[model samples]
Target: TQLLEQSPQFLSIQEGENLTVYCNSSSVFSSLQWYRQEPGEGPVLLVTVVTGGEVKKLKRLTFQFGDARKDSSLHITAAQTGDTGLYLCADLTTSGTYKYIFGTGTRLKVLA
Candidate 1:
């Protein structure tokens, strides 16, 4: 079994400020998915980066995979005040036995 630990459990920044959230693990995995979860709602998958130097971007957010496939990061640029709720990262492995894990989650509060 493996665990995904997210850093900066809470974030508070101005609307124009930029920030980065990280989800790290000690064990390697197959794929890592980044999710954005709003209050009273299920997590929405932003992007998934397969093992290697793959990167995916959506609007103001960019997701990157570690070269070793054991870690991932999410960068938000020019964040807006409306960016509320929380963000979570999950990983899946398809070797030996299937495993799925979710990060502790990072709550973001963008101030106007």
Candidate 2:
């Protein structure tokens, strides 16, 4: 089973608000990826962190990987209603099938 854990099971905020989501695990991962899933559709990859202490940004979103490679976070600045969805973090394992075990997921709703 996937060992990743995500905090803030649900969130609701104003359109201009800021929010942060966390993903943690006891097991270290070779690579970690973040995805956003809208209703009735599969998740779309947001960012991928391969090295420890790595940080990547996409527009108003920032993603970081912990120094131990067992934790990660996603921070959104000036959130919009378009950001409403389920945010998932995934760990890339060595199972040779490129399998992804997703986090518990954070369901976010941004009100206009």
List the candidates' TM-scores in order. Answer: 0.91, 0.94
Q: Candidate 1 has which clashing residue pairs, if any? A: none
lDDT of 2 by residue, 1-112 (tens): 4588899999999999999999998699878999999999999999999999999999999999999998999999999999999999988787768787889999999999
User: Considering every candidate listed, which one attains the maximal lDDT?
Assistant: 2
Off by over 4 Å in 1: 94-99
Looking at model 2, report the run of 10 residues with the lowest lDDT sum.
Answer: 91-100
Compared with the true structure, model 1 gives a TM-score of 0.91
lDDT of 1 by residue, 2-103 (tens): 789998899999899899999998688667888889888899888888857788889999888888888888999999976777999988865577776788
Per-model root-mean-square deviation over C-alphas:
1.6, 1.3
